[model samples]
Target: MKKSLPAIAPGLPLGLLLGLSTAAPRAFAQEAAAPALEAAASLNAGDTAWMLTSTMLVILMVIPGLALFYGGLVRSKNMLSVLAQVFTIFALITVLWAIYGFSLTFGGTGLFYGGFDKLFLAGITPDTLSATLGTIPEYVFVAFQSTFAAITVALIVGAFAERMKFSAVMIFSVLWFTLSYIPMAHMVWGGGLLAEDGALDFAGGTVVHINAAVAGLVGAIMVGKRIGFGKEAMPPHSLTLTMVGASLLWVGWFGFNAGSAGAANGIAGLAFINTILATGAATVAWLVAEGLHKGKASMLGAASGAVAGLVTITPAAGLVGPMGSIAMGVIAGPLCLWGVSGLKRLLKADDVCDVFGIHGVGGILGAILTGVFCAASLGGVEPEGFSMAAQVWVQCKSVLITVVWCAVASFLCFKVADLLVGLRVSEEDERRGLDIAVHGERAYVS
Candidate 1:
């Protein structure tokens, strides 16, 4: 080495030689780190695209899907009121979610609530990534979750439709969304107490369906029954519109369930097929039950059954096999029928659209059965050290916590609305129907 260095390094110091020897390895390491840095920052185009589509589909569920579904179920006198309530709630919640809702939901590590670290979505740019979702941009995740929040508030409107004051509805929605919806979402999906305790909710069995149902039940009781609820026939004015809305809900629910998987991978595919199978099975089961009970299957029964099946399979969409989904659907149809009829009479609450019956009952059934079917022995993608009994107990605990939280918070929210603006319209306004009475517009001018 000394002989070779004689030409150019004749006067080179020993220190300079040592420095040069170490520089080469350092340069190599710097070069090697460049690829890893790039990889860590890179976004998957396919996943980003899928998530964007999923966000749009969920929005569809709130607007025309849920709006029409609830609208058609109410009397013609309150049709426009239902439509207006659903549409306005969607818009209002979307704005709130962008402001502080997202932060309090997914920002902190708290057991009950997240921090305000992401208020106004601070510091999150297009380049930002979701730590939980990993492959998609953080913006996509925020948008997707906002839709769930909006629909949850909208779902409560059906329970108090045709009677609640417009101003009261607005005030109650804001309060309940802040107090109940946000915290429950954190507990189940945002890695809070239930999540840490291993409660399985693949898509929103606890957070969306049960949470909204409990709120709906509370509202139904607090708002009082519609005028002539049991005395008069309050049949649906337009079954055709309901069917269309149900169809849209069915289509959009694919995004709700499969998109929970967060990627266009095998799990998403599994969820998609399960949704179709379970929904179809539930529809048939409901038809059979209705025919046996009433000697005829109405279109309304079919639509209700389909929704029951959809809600039942939502929590287990990605966790269980197709056959398991079918079983859940079959059970949900009959159970929810009883929920709307017998259970409705038992509770003595006039849930206009049966939100508590289908969504509440179906969600509870699906959540508990998910624990049973999620075992590897039952053809599910089991978690590590999976035990059906332990998981079912965990599911029950989560459900109980959610029901209690929602019922209490909803009661407070309704009381707040009643204090500030009054919970129900006057007798004259209610008798005249909410459409022309509240909004000064008619759904159909006769």
Candidate 2:
């Protein structure tokens, strides 16, 4: 004659009251558990290892990879200067990123910039997890993201190479990194405005390539052409070195594109394969375009094509399939060739290394095409409630925003650096070569 109840849902004399008193507290306790507990539950060794490896690869891309690539493109007099600029920029940004850069980039809940709550990594610890990748320690995420800031700033050096003062380069990079790179990182990757609007940047098309390209273009214009630029031949000092540097960049980009997935999962694998396919296709497409246009496919064209493909595939790596990535590469090759050649002539900026031509045009192209290829109909990872047209609009919006922000910020930063320390070397020093005049060393001992 006792009231019967389900075994799992024990019918207490006061069912609602007892449930609130006992079950509610337990649920609250679970929700309020410490980060250490969460880490124990979800810390993934495989993902952590992969991210660490990726971090190293990206660092390699900056030091020897970018350094040598830019170095080989300049006259021998400026070779060492290129190395010095790239190395110093990398070192400086790494320090700044540790100080307040990480905090202002990913700490706060703001539309444009992050808060300074994590200044000098204030409260972060070995057990702290990143908001985006909960499985990895927050420190790993900081290191990984910091490398991105370094490479992006380093990319600007190529535009004004052989003319700018080393001091000016240092000052400008600090200002731009603090102002431009940090804000863009926050907006796209740090849960800020662009992210809120559902803009996609898998590995930094808008953030890295496009942002740097715009900044470089501005710097090239503001700094003025190298001495005797129009009249001088300005041939690359060493194509052999350029080829070697390009090879390193190609190898290191696997980490750049694939590592963006934030996990050692299927998406990472997809990014990896797509990077390989897209780069190869771009190489072929570039050579074909050059062969038809110039009557020969040179090593420079091949190297340029490879980089174009890499840039085009960066933002869409994980979102699209291999074939889609190949399509992007094929399109980017010729377009970027024109960017460095015809468009370079039109812009009339020195662009010592074609930063605008390759990175700028390729990034805009890739970012837009990502919208097309990310549709499930094109063998992409399907987004929930996806519309191709809507997504393309969002992509274009992101690109436009990045272009405007970077252009203005770069122009301002260059002007500031010019005010602080002269932006250019003395004409005499420039003619003498930065290696001996500025740094008192030579790339070649001759």
Q: Which 10-residue window of candidate 2 scores lowest in summed lDDT?
A: 12-21
- Superposed model 1: Cα runs more than 4 Å off: 1-41
Query: Model 2: per-residue lDDT, tens digit, 191-306?
Result: 67776666767888988999999999999999998889889799999988888888889888878887887767777788899999999999999999999999999999999999
Question: Clash number for model 1?
Answer: 0
TM-score against truth, every candidate? 0.91, 0.91
lDDT of 1 by residue, 26-119 (tens): 2332343344334534577877888889888888888899989988998899999999999999999999999999999889867878899899
Model 1 — TM-score against the truth? 0.91
